[model samples]
Target: MVLPALMLFVAVVLIPLAMTVLLSFNDWGQYKGIEQVFILKNWREIWEDDYFLEMFLRTFRIAVLATLITALLGAPEAYILNRMQGRWKGFFLLVILGPLLISVVARTLGWALLFGGANGVVNKALMSLGVIGAPIPFMFTETGVVVALAHVMMPFMVLSVWAALQRVDPQIENAAMSLGAGHATILRRIVLPQIMPGILSGAIIVFSLSASAFATPSIIGGRRLKVAATLAYDEFLNTLNWPLGAAVAVLLLVALVLIVVGSNALIERRYAEVFR
Candidate 1:
């Protein structure tokens, strides 16, 4: 049973990862077709290149911000949903799952229109309210990208935390409340501890998804903002620089792995007593 799954994992994940690592070391252009010469040039260039480094950090920052925002908003929403009764619960759950029904490209395109300049609905509404003399720039900016990414990633965060919230015993919460614990106190002391796993998992998913997202950022961010994933896409498709693109892909994979492992380790260490 386990062996077949393990074999599938190796075939689907490990082989491609190995190829990407190998390709990163050798310089190759589209027409050149892998020169087969191994060198550290790609790695060296990536390290010394300020643009690549900045884009890498920018991707990390946006991902973190999106994940944090998702947690702050999603956790409460999940809690509320968990406490709801009857048909409303199913309706809210369906609403959260609604975004998944739409194509991401279509959703992002909708955001592009909403964030558009002067003629956009948002700007027009604000202008009509006399809030600003001119339209605020959102399209092709980091703020726009972040907003769109957050919207795209919110459902995952909510669903994950909701699953965790479901496992928490209402009896424990009631007991805490009967003991004179306030709402905040019961939540912080009783509810949060049990739901930490869900929060962590959701954050991990959001961070990874947002960091690698191409459509939302590309459409909302436009040509001005460059994220690691977009940069990789440009190098591979536009510039035809296979080696550089491979290096960026590998860097992204490494960064995501480190974050996930580090988060899991921290959660396990901090919750050792609870787990035992």
Candidate 2:
């Protein structure tokens, strides 16, 4: 049973990935079929272009910031939820999980309205508060992009962090308290250390998701900030450059692989240290 499923997964995921790697090295353009010989132009071009580096830097920065900010926001929420019992717990889970069920298009549209220029709720509220003399630049800027991406990626981090938090035996906390540890000391010495793995796992998910996100950044970033995913989308879909686009896709995939592998190793090391 599992063999068939595993085979199917390999067929779908690994096969395309292998195909993309082959495509990235070839110049399969509109003028040519898969007949073209392999070339390093795509990789070379990406490396030489300063703007490309900026786009990648911006993307990396945005993803990092969004993951950190959302983790901060979600960790407390997850902790609170994990502590609760009964109907309230289920209801709260429903609330957190509700957004996952909603279409990404729908969520993006909602944020667009709030962040719309001038008459928008966000701009209007800020203006009323006299925080700025003019509507602060948003909806196409890095700040707006980060804000939107954080909301979209929050749930993954929250659940992971919560699971980590819940796994820390209650006895450890009680023992900390019994040993004359302050609230802050208990949190720092015991609770925080135990939950570190969960937080790292959440950050890994959040980072990967945001890094690969195209829609939210496209709609909310509004063409101003181009993340790596959108660049691939434009190259493959818009320009009909399969080879170049596939190359970009492969790049994104490689980045994801590296981050996940490195982060998991770090998590494992921390787990060993903490458990030892």
Candidate 3:
């Protein structure tokens, strides 16, 4: 049973990944196009270039911020949703997930319109509310990208924490309350610990997706602010530097794999007794 699945995985995922890795070792030029010869030129260029360094750092920074925002907001929202009863729960859940039903491109374009510089809807609304003295730049900025990406990725975080909440015993809270534990203490000690796995799982999902995200970042950050994904896209499509793009993509994949695996290991260790 597992053999067939493993074979399918190798065929669908591993083959393309291996090919991409091989392609990264090949050479490319403006006039020459892609040359079949294997070399470390692409990798070496990425390693030595400060531009690549800044771009990767910016990419991870945005991903981290987006993940943190989602965790902070989504965890609480999920808790609230879990506590609600009947149709109200379903209604709010639907509203929370409405964004997921739309095309990511469409959603991002909507954000682009809202984030239309100083005259944008967001800025105007804030100005009207006296939230700021002047318009803030949203279009073509990292803040815009982070905000959009967080919105896009929020559903995953909420759903993950909701699932974790399902495994939690409601009586535990009651038991703690019976022992003279206040609401805050019960929540801090009993609820959060139980839901931690979900939060970590959601963080992994959000962070990984955010890091590799292309569309939202491209639309929000524009040409001036380039993340790793957009930079790879430019190299492949605009510059016609497929080898270089492949290298960048492979590096991103490797980084994400390492980070996710490390995160999982830490989570497992920390939650060993609880999970067991």
Candidate 4:
């Protein structure tokens, strides 16, 4: 049973991945078919391009910031949710998950409307309250992209941390509280360690999703901001540079893999050091 599933997975994922790796090495200048003349030109050129580097760095920064924001927002919510009971729990859970049901494009478009200049709802409300004389720049900005990505990724972080919190024994917290342990101490020493795995998982998912996101960034960030994903889109679709686009895609994939693996390793190392 597992063998068939594994084979199917390899066929769908690994095969394309292998092809992408191969494509990244070849130069396909104005050619439609797969180029046989393989070289290091594509990777070398992309690596040296300042614009490409800027886009990659921006993508990385956005992903990290979004993941951190999600964690900060989600962690406390998860802790609170774990303490809740009955109908309220389910209702709140549904609320957190409500955005997931909406299409990504639709969600992004909604944000675009809210972040629109001058007459936008958010700007209008803020202006009415005398918060600002003029609308703050959001549309086509990095801040706009990060805000929307965080909103989209928050649910995953919340659910992951919530699941982790569920596994924690409440009696342990009760015992700590009875022993006169401060809330901060209990949270730092007990709650955080147990939920670290969940945070790590959530961070990985959020970071990967945000880094690869095209629709939200493209729509919200507009042409002014260019992340690695958008650059890849332009290279492949707009410029028709398949090899270069493939190289960019490979680099993005490698970056995600490193982030995931590096996070796991760091967590494991910290756990060992703390325990030892």
In terms of TM-score, which candidate is strongest?
Answer: 3
Each candidate: RMSD: 2.2, 2.1, 1.5, 1.9
Cα displacement (angstroms), candidate 2, residue 95, comes to: 1.3
Say what the RMSD of model 4 is: 1.9
* Model 4, span 25-51: residue lDDT tens: 876766565575779998889878788
lDDT of 2 by residue, 1-276 (tens): 699999999999999899888888886556665555779988988889887788788888999999999888998888888889999999999899888999887898798889888677888898899987788667889888898889988889889988897677988879879989998898788877777778888999899989988889999886667888888888877778878878888888898899899989987887788679
What lDDT does each candidate get?
A: 0.90, 0.85, 0.95, 0.91
Where does the lowest 10-residue lDDT sum fall in candidate 4? 27-36
Indicate the worst ten consecutive residues by lDDT in candidate 1: 27-36
Which candidate leads the pack in lDDT? 3
Better of 3 and 4 by TM-score: 3
Clash pairs (backbone) in predicted model 3: none
Local accuracy of candidate 1 as per-residue lDDT tens digits, 33-102 = 6676789888999999898889999999989998988999999999999999999999998999999999
- List TM-scores for all candidates, in order: 0.91, 0.91, 0.96, 0.93
As a TM-score, model 2 comes out at 0.91
- List candidate 3 stretches off by more than 4 Å: 273-276
Model 1 clashing-pair count: 0
